[model samples]
Target chain A: MEPAEVEFLAEKEPVTVIPNFSLDKIYLIGGDLGPFNPGLPMEVPLWLAVNLKQRQKCRIVPPEWMDVEKLEEIREQERREDTFTPMPSPHYMELTKLLLNHASDNIPKADEIRTLVKDIWDTRLAKLRLSADRFVREQETYAKLDNLTLMEINTTAAFFTESLNHMYKLRTNLQPSEGAESQEY
Target chain B: MADELELFEQGSDAGSDEVLLTPAELIHQLEEAWLNEKFAPDLLESKSEIVECVIEQLSHMEENLQRAKKGDLKVSIHRMEIDRIRYVLSSYLRSRLLKIEKFFPHVVEKEKLRAKEDPSALSPEEFAFAKEYLENTEMFLKNVTLKHMPPNLQSIDLLKSVPQPNLDSFVFLRVKERQENILIEPETDEQREYTVDLEEGSQHLIRYKTIAPLVTSGAVQLI
Candidate 1:
């Protein structure tokens, strides 16, 4: 999957926005969205929030997990664990990038949050690579990857799966008779 | 009122499979189908009903928006939503077309072999497209390349020449339904096969062949 597509999914996530202008409730196909009152915080999708922010009509309230201290704790937990750690949000990385890139002024200490997210991402990716290597070395057919997020998986899914397919092809060729049917792609 | 709405929905293909999903649920299904089609190695069963409903919904909303005053915030937001849905819908259809082009012969063969009662893997339009594509490719080969070959080599078996989908290819999936005692096939001789219970909401890396049925059944989602 494209990184942009991952970001697209992240855009569906709801974020609180304080609209500066009041408006009536609008009926949308997916659902309805607020009868806005000035200064009242209302929940809208991240895409709408970003657009409203761009138009200077609202202020984006950063998601609670975007805090500097909480992320540091998650980063520590990630480094200390041998297995994948659960993320605050499944699209945490993509959400952080989107919010910071488009509405940085709305978020406090954007630089620190950005650096912290990168650290957690790097740590998770390194762990993912190590486990992938072990999985290949062991010739294992199944792996439980409960804590891994879509963006992290997408980064390695194509390359990892192709190499495994090649390895499977080579292994079956050596045996010749047993797995003959599956050998052909 | 609810009964009347349900009766109205029953007139369309959308009501045939399952209960009527709200417009929101229809959008969500389209996105899910988009991602599934994007990741799976082969063409999946067609979602033409959902596709049609979404298009209808979008056009209906679009016509309503047209009469509204310009520069309205609601109008713009609706337009953005429309564009987003259009993107996913087109991407889903485009990926199916790409797979159709790559494995046209096999796809056509499968369509032929399917029982009359089963839902077609290709929608009516797609089936026509595939047939036309197959015919055009064969004609191009015969006219441009095959005619020049020796008499015995004149014919080409597309089913043999074209590669089949690697059904055994590894795919990443998230289980939506808890399944007990699913067997795992070992990659090599040394490892013994074992069964694992797929707990709901857990993710796994496994062979596509093992979970293809699960994918079709909507018990697991290909990530």
Candidate 2:
């Protein structure tokens, strides 16, 4: 789901409504990088709040049109079936990176974003550690093979491909926005 | 969903699209607050303890309302992103799980084939590969499920503490679930709970039941 879409629902109520001043507003209000401008410490908690919320709602399927009630049902069903798994969507993963990139450079919310990255990892530690151990064993297994059947090679190859993608997404989503992308703010 | 930012940009009725703060307005508010002594007091004293307490109650109710309307948007998104990764991993696991489960059957089949004079001799290399595959596959699966670690272990770190107000508002989420009469005790009053079904990853907003709007048609607060 798009951040804008998420923001739309968040905005429906007035109490939590955040103002929508543009970038120009940032310059106008925060003021130019002048001596008088009191550089505010980043709102680390706010950014963390956003990212952590994303992690809490991680599910196994993409949310194309499913509502909250339907999504919960799906979660419950998957749990009952013992097939529930958690992974990140490639599309949102990219957006998350975009968010990180933007936050690092432009948004003063970098501290909060940093906290968020830490939080997501905390929630998925079990899964991540398991994945690491599995990878080590797979490498050892693959090395022992002298002559392999077509099927054996195919299976190993597929596993590697999947593992690689999973790891990439995890790293991108879980990594903090620091020196990787240089944003002057 | 329409990009909330664009809605803020155009300033026309975003057709139900809402934004946290118009970037400009938020920044302006922040600047104004800076000009005032608000930050000084917040910095000097413990960070707005009283305000934080009030907010904690407010946010709990707010989170419930939002979740009911949007059906836990954050979780929904995380789950979908996970699907792409899970697809590949699940297939790999199924194949390996099946292979392991059929290990004894395969051995018997090979023996039977040999007895029939259809010698499908298995090489040492083949034997080793099969054994290694199962061992590693099992290891990998266990790690992903956190079977090796405590189930409730704080596996991932949170970006921020849950807003206290958001927590307070969360009572509304429960109201949707049971539909039982919400018990509102003065000391430990729980707000009404509601649940929204998101079959197609779609949801709408639910106006909060308890607390009235705070900002009331004024410029948004920067902090």
Best by lDDT: 1
TM-score versus the correct structure, for each prediction: 0.94, 0.16
Chain A TM-score, cand. 1: 0.92
Kindly list the per-residue Cα lDDT of model 1 for residues B1-223, writing each as its tens digit: 0111111222223235445677887788788889889889989999887888888888888899999999888899989999999999999999999999988999999999998867688999999999999999999888988899999989977777777788889999999899998899987788799999999999999998898878887888988
Off by over 4 Å in 1: A174-185, B1-18
Best by DockQ: 1
Tens-digit per-residue lDDT, A1-185, candidate 1:
88889889888999999999999997877788999999999999899999999999999999999999999999999999999999999999988998999899989999999999999999999999999999998999999999999999999999999999899888777453333443132
Candidate 1 accuracy as TM-score: 0.94
**DockQ-derived CAPRI band for the predicted complex in model 1:** medium
lDDT of all predictions: 0.88, 0.29
Top model by TM-score, which number? Answer: 1
After TM-score superposition, the amount by which residue B46's alpha carbon in candidate 1 deviates from its true location, in angstroms, is: 0.6
